[model samples]
Target chain A: MNSTDQNAPLLEVRNLSKHFGAVRALNDFSMAVRPGEVVALAGDNGAGKTTLIKAISGVFQPTGGEILLGGQPVAFATPQEAREKGIETIYQDLALADNLSIGANIFLGREPMRKAFGFLPVLDRKAMAEAARETMKRLDFHVSRMNAPVSNFSGGQRQAVAIGRAVYWDAQILIMDEPTAALGVPEQRKVISLIHQLKAQGRGVIFISHNLQDIFAVSDRIVVLRRGVQAGERKISETNHDEVVKLMVGG
Target chain B: MTSTSPAQPAEKHVAPQADHGDPATSLIGRIAEGRAWLFLAGLIICFEIWSRVAFGATFVLNPFNLQSIAIFAVAPLLLATGQTFVIISGGIDLSLGFIMGLAAVIAAHATNMAGAAIPLPLAMLAGILAAVIVAGVPGVINGLLISRLRVPPFIGTLGMFGVARGVAFLLAGGTTVPVRNSWFALLGNGRFYGVPYLVLIAAVFVIVMHYLLSQTRFGQHNYAIGANVQAARRAGIDIRGHILRLYVLSAMCAGLGGALYAARFTAGAAQAGEPLLLDSVAAVVIGGASLFGGSGTILGTVAGALVIAVIQYGLVFVNVEPFWQFIAVGVVIIISVLIDQAQRRFSGGRQDE
Candidate 1:
């Protein structure tokens, strides 16, 4: 491994731990995510990938250890607070309102409002639609229309919308959990391309996936978590899929 | 080489994939897509035919009869509007009838205590406040249990149903409380420009609700939470607060409806809105709102209420037995539910295929 110490990472975790009753979901795990980088998190089922993500995303507060963002010690009591601090997570389910239009889903909670005559406020649907179109275009996503309900969109298109939502909200650190899971080959390709696009935009991405091909394709580095602890970190150039799998199994 | 470009073959496949050939034109297709509106239209037509032909024809388009329909429909309209939010969020509030009853009793009692010297508006306000408070309690409980404790909404609201009804009976001493305020009657019985105040209030509430549900951030969150709660949570939505407010708003509306009912009748009877519970659920179902959550409209619920009211008036106009009106409502509810199920199944099949 090339040991190069550069500028501080965007996110750093030290001895982060969590216990669900008698079950130890995460234990003394540590990692760093630098800006403009994609770090793939791989582990076997029940290896605490979700727990670690939940801890970082503020879904489940860690029972111990500290999390620092931009080298400043911070704690998030709620996911909303975490989001405000630019830590956004996209779960495997995508967490989108399928009945809403793509534009609506993209701006679900924090919608832009237009002030007409200084008092009467209205939703800026046109502006939102335009932004959605632009964002999707930037990602090379060819959705036919922004007005269509998200339920009608294919899986790849929906993921694009989800990612667009997080990115549009100015999320500096993006944590995507199994984004390509349950998708077809073409859909997986679309998501991989989008991830690369996000990296190109200078955002730090923590990608969780079991597919090694996907990990090797988009990740700048791989962080394997074996049974709630960081097994090791491997640079994309220095490590092959087999070595990463071995580390994932704590070899 | 030019003829064998890879983009040409990909483009060919794209055209066929995009043109899945208009599923909207097929028999099951139209039903799956447009059944909600179709059911609403069909109900109106049935009521129109029955009110005009079966009845002695004197009631058709008559102002007095129209006013009666409005008065009869207002309670259900208010109840269904509240139910619309609850159902769209994939929950049910069966305690609405009891909550309404409690509100009626409280309003009547408060209005009477305010004495003859008090102005009618203040008395009305008192009643509204009382009902809002009583209704809000069950809502808070429902919200806490459903959101915080993770209790099933049905079980939570059902328990509230018993508690609220018992409170109503207890407060009223199991008897009717007569409202003596003359001005309070004006709200229920008075008319402005030929429109009954009762109908006008119902109209305003429906319009406000329609805008809130269709155009606001709150409405978006409601649908998101209803369609999938975990997804909503992951999206950083405050699910607990939203559900709490949803149930509170629903109960508050029911409370307001109860106050309106008390004004219309000049008496608060414990049993006044008992039948409304079933009718409200029926109206919501008939209006094409999904009980499973994530789909509904105020317009649909309004139409559903009108359909029910028209049926009731038609039965009275035709001099049919009172019990027959009950049977008719039951049949309507059953038919509406079946249509809803069929539409859901048809849509599900299409999505799977």
Candidate 2:
């Protein structure tokens, strides 16, 4: 890919709109995420940040408009399809299976399988564990053991594993929904560093958060959504938090 | 900022270091999470003791009697496996017993209609088909009502319980339908490699179910749905279709179990499995499956079924009245739930601390 191609936005939504009965969850919500940039999505609760993320991640098909990946229009019928197109989403709850081990949760839905020699095929646990360890290491995740069940991990470590799973799957566009909503200050810093690392790897990241301080620290650009419509998009260096908040409130 | 960073690192290190004082702490966590399996072991030990005291030996250890113990355990084992899937998906199929009974009656009627005229394979196929259809219809209905209409699975399956049992009685004229096919008798009673075919079938089901629950995408979705349906949906899982399939799969297993029962008995009574409803649930609960859903294993269900079987067999070995077996099963079920609650409370405390 040329510099233009490399710098080009990986995902672009144009005039997207979605209506849930009498309410419009999104309206003309257009945004673009360039490669190697962390775009912060900041809005008040119910300001359609989630709705926009869902639409882009293919959880809900937009009632109107086009989504472009690499400047070509693409439609995703399912989240799996979106995932196949290299869009990985880590939701607020992290979607970890508590009963399963950290490795299992990371490799859930897609597992490594060795060829069947006779009547039985085997799960390649060694390969999976090795890959899980590598992925965790790359993300700078320090945990007691990869064999331990995810329930044993603290909130921040769990979040790291969730992010690692997405990154390991080669997600080109990472959408994180409130990555540090409930974490303490140190944990928040850990996640922020991870986000920076994700952006540094030349992948586009859409960071949805209510914390403007964290947003300013990490985001190159900030997009504001208000009642299902795009309020504005501003370079993080140019706009103050009050202006962003005002735009988010539709003032 | 420097003091805070160092202090925070020290604090984080302290908590994990404290946990490291005993390498057994993590092992304890693992064991606690697997407390259901532990409880199962305890049950087995208790039964072993009772059997030795009553019969002057461990009855299950006797090679000649092992087949009988297995034969008696297969039906409930199959039923428990099916129930585990249903329950793990955050639903209960109360219709399981009735559906099994209905399947048995259907299979019997089919076998009788064939009555030496049809080829043995055809007759068996006919019986299996009849049972599958009988059990599958209600499953589809349950799935539709629960998935599309958003009815509570409890109400839908309970309603199915009544409907299926009533249909079985109507078809059998409120009595046991005699098995006229000789092959059906052989199928139920025959042995392969000294193991009863019915037992083999149940074992196969356990293996298949274990693979499905542990290795497949459907299994992951089932756990996800049970853990949190909304989250599963948000992850792009087809919650409705998956839930429908789960109910159908469960019912199909019940249907097969019923067929096995009819083959074994050479007759299909309307109330054949009526008493097994609670027993089946008891088996799964005893195996360590949560009633609230999201966690369980086929092995657990198998162990649970065997536990029930051992309790029943142990009672006979000890010359205790059969009626007391029911009370024992009831007591075991209560204790299993209490143990699960205690485990949860312990884990909850750990999480809080």
Candidate 3:
């Protein structure tokens, strides 16, 4: 059976809880995503899957919990902080600026800067274009023009651009929320393979999805969340689709 | 590493027809596609022809009339540039006109204070500074209300429209404040080697703001925020702060425009900038900047402002009643909007992929 290594998990959440007034969105939920692992986060609607992922990615701060990154306790007051710490999240809609150029979108907030006036800083377009080109070439990502708007790219190309952005920053832990939900069958398959490629690179990935088939095809470990709590954790080799389905639906 | 390239995903079987390699063909395509250039060129040509045939060419740019055209054009151009930022950022300021009026009043007061103790130059600086701050603070309030209090920009700025105008009147007691300094008069009427100082100042702002919109990270973020605010926030942009600054810029520009107008007339009346709000908006809208926001160019807006001036001046040059100028501008705004809607439908369909 597949088992988690004794080594520290890349990200460990201890009794994480988030309460929206009386909603109690997430209650004492805890999970771990480890290096070189594809941890499938399977949960039905309102199962706190979104809350959990958002908290981890710093979109929402858990009301009660301690999060350790690489065994070092960290607090992310903003997504930028989490990103600066080498953790990236691909939001459900890709969160890309549709009208901006690919290079501009990839390097949106953390643009490379040059000194324009003694100490004042301005965007270093040359350096940014060069970096974007080099990164795309290395990652084998095909964007027709670095200057073209992201809106022109297809659904699959947009996803790849999102992935390229995550990889460009050399994020250690990748959190993808329903990556293939809006994509077609062929695009879905492409994303699954991309997940495998990230795994081969020894990076940890937390894959959130509603599709049980996708969860089984790629995950090394499965973490099913139910009503804001961790209902079960399994080794994919030791679990079956029916059992995971029951766990997800709270049987 | 898995022999799977993320760039050429399996579903992406088609690539867009590549850009034409020929520079001349590509340039022609871009100009045609841009639409704004064509509309502007057409307006200029039509006006040139109308003036040449109906009236003597001198009516268009005679020695005395050139100054008037330069004078009337500068105010709308500055206000429209600021409004371009407002619209592209997905907001509108109904208070800009009144904000200008208030700034003019304050500037007039400061100019009158110039000869005593304060040197004339220092007094002008104080006047400009006073006007800018008075005008800019309402922008801050507008931003804070919209960002922190969750007030809609339209309502917030609408409230500011009344507040700024009321306060301007309260300060002035509903009267014009006149200045005694000829130096301030020189600012309004002074010529630097035959070029109006006002046009020179407005031109500088045009170049600077153009660079700001087209070349900076801040400019990119402005476009992004208006494009998809949620996406912008997710990308870790400080949306509230950036928007606040844009409003400040908008107000500062309006204030500058008003103060200059007051200097030219040597008096600050509470209603001095009454035409500012509508005129600036018309220029921005006619410039092809989307009222729905997220897209605009400074040069296009400048052209739009010039179109308004051309129509107004051209009507007078051709001996048409001056009131027809308003009707013409109203017609242009409608046509501009029609063009914008049509272009959005047209260009958005180009990527058949």
Which candidate leads in TM-score? Answer: 3
Per-model TM-score, in order, reads 0.86, 0.86, 0.89
Winner on TM-score between 1 and 3 is 3
User: What are the per-residue Cα lDDT tens digits for candidate 3 across B258-289?
Assistant: 88888889888889878868989998888778
Candidate 1 residues B15-40, lDDT tens each? 11131234462456445345446655
Residue-wise C-alpha lDDT for candidate 2, range B162-188, written one tens digit per residue: 999999899989889988777788889
Q: What is the docking quality class of candidate 3?
A: acceptable
Sort the candidates on DockQ, descending order.
Answer: 3, 1, 2
Off by over 4 Å in 2: A1-6, A13-31, A46-48, A59-67, A73-81, A106-108, A119-126, A224-234, A238-251, B1-23, B29-65, B120-122, B191-194, B351-353
Chain B TM-score (each prediction, in order): 0.88, 0.89, 0.90
Worst 10 residues of 3 chain A by lDDT: A1-10
Q: Can you list each candidate's DockQ?
A: 0.23, 0.16, 0.33
In terms of lDDT, model 2 sits at 0.80
lDDT of each: 0.80, 0.80, 0.80
Clash pairs, model 3 backbone: A142-B7
Fnat score for model 1: 0.29
Highest-DockQ candidate: 3
Q: Encode model 1's per-residue lDDT on A1-251: one tens digit a residue.
A: 01133346779999999998988889999998876788999999988899998889887799999999988888988888899898999878888888777777878777777775787566778888898888877766766556756776677778888999888888889999999997887778778878877776767899999999989888878988888888888998899978988898775
